[model samples]
Target: MLTVILYHVIFVIVVYTDTGPPYNAFPQKLNFYYFSLYVIPSTTCFFIVLLSTIFLVVKVRRNQRWRKGTSTQTAKTNDKEDKLVRTIIAISTIFIICSFPTVSIFITQIIHKQFRYRDPYLGTLLLLMFNIGGVFQAISSSVNIFFYYRMSSRFKKVFASLFACRRSGIQGTKPSD
Candidate 1:
């Protein structure tokens, strides 16, 4: 319920927020693709992940304190929940770290009323930073697969079995075998 309301608020903000004119990619002309696809989605994911992690961590800790006298099963359940929270934290941290540069650029553009790309060197630097940020975003996404494999035995087993089946299917079907 809270999440739905939060998303609606975010949607309103995303629809109303205007991009600044400083950056070459995102001008004040208001491109729908930029707002709808890139900006809104990026901002929404960042906020949702961040807020969810904070709320979930708080709830989990509160529950732990309240259930201090519970049995071992409750303790195990708390341990599992703690692990899940940690994973969420790790993922959100990586996402924020990767997307920091891009967000910074956007913020800078918003703050500066005039275009900041008059100097060629500054423009080049911003372009490079944007590209580096994109690379980092890709790395962050790819690393989540490794995290899943590391943290979840089920995921690891399924991934391994899928690959093993492919390998066997390729090697086991030789006519000379």
Candidate 2:
């Protein structure tokens, strides 16, 4: 899926960030460990979360696709459930959009020197923006479950049943494949 590809994209950017005549830390031995471990994993998580949100939203939207003569707009407007899904998608989209520039900026700066133009001030600023955006985005991810519950009845039912099992002290059995 695109989620996996996004991870690779960020990875490529990370590699690129170290290329050419640029900021040297990324290309240095000391930074190698942190770059390969923490930075890569965190960047992958960000892209995975983003792409998953997009996939869910697209699935919801696809369900409301217009038939030959039916009105897509009408369905969204008239149906409360679709409207709720639309809202969830909208909120998720906004969060993803707001964070993308920051994420990309940091990735670009890390992998490419052109973004910072070798200026320490610009480097500090990009890093600051990326860190701040990531913190806020983490909060947004945490709230996604509530939105899913409100927007998708299937999700709500599964969540309820899972909690119900815990309340009853019953270990839920997995279904046979």
Candidate 3:
């Protein structure tokens, strides 16, 4: 986590220095740096999450098979595990769907230098795509709460309590001694 924070800090510093005042346009020279820092790390993290989820699902299935004739307690535990695995898969799928546009833009930019926000013809389209991607990214970051609330009873209770109205006392008065 520290390394990830440090890596992003370095990226911010580099981009800030490269862009100078106003920072209207990114330095084309740093395209490779952007690709290496942002694209590669994000892609790697996505794949890692995907692969780990797959392994977890396989392990859970294997356990379920072995515990087929186990006690009711084990069955309940397996049901919880199944919900968790499903939640993870849903989250991973959302992440991939949301990130696709941004990743596609990055790779496209790298392959065709002419394809960017400055192009006279494609500039508007590219900007729109970028904005849509940003919206999707925001959704990806926030939508996990809904999944947890839906899939996990404990999460649902805790989440509800966070917003649940409470009556401290009648008419805002303190309780009688």
Q: Give TM per candidate.
A: 0.71, 0.50, 0.76
RMSD of 3: 4.1
Candidate achieving the largest lDDT: 3
Select the stronger candidate by lDDT from 1 and 3. 3
lDDT of 2 by residue, 1-177 (tens): 696567657756766665534646454542564456445665666687678877877776676564424754544454765666686666667667666755676587578755553466676776677677777778676777777787777888999999998977754555579
Window of ten residues with lowest summed lDDT in model 2 = 25-34
lDDT tens readout by residue for model 1, 32-125:
5344545565666767777887888898888777677564446577778777777777877888888877777666655753424445556777
Clashes found in each candidate (C-alpha, N, C closer than 3 A): 0, 3, 0
In model 1, the runs with Cα more than 4 Å from the true position are 1-37, 70-75, 115-121, 175-177
Residue runs of model 2 more than 4 Å from their true location after superposition: 1-81, 84-88, 103-114, 170-177
Say which prediction, candidate 1 or candidate 3, comes out ahead on TM-score. Answer: 3
Native-to-model Cα distance after best TM-score fit, residue 58 in candidate 1, in Å: 1.7
lDDT for every model?
A: 0.71, 0.65, 0.79
Give Cα distance to truth, residue 171, candidate 1, Å. 2.5
Candidates 1 and 2, the one with greater TM-score: 1
Show model 3 residue runs off by greater than 4 Å: 18-28, 69-73, 165-177
Superposition error at 77 for model 3 (Å): 2.3
RMSD of each: 6.6, 9.1, 4.1
Full candidate order by lDDT, most accurate first: 3, 1, 2
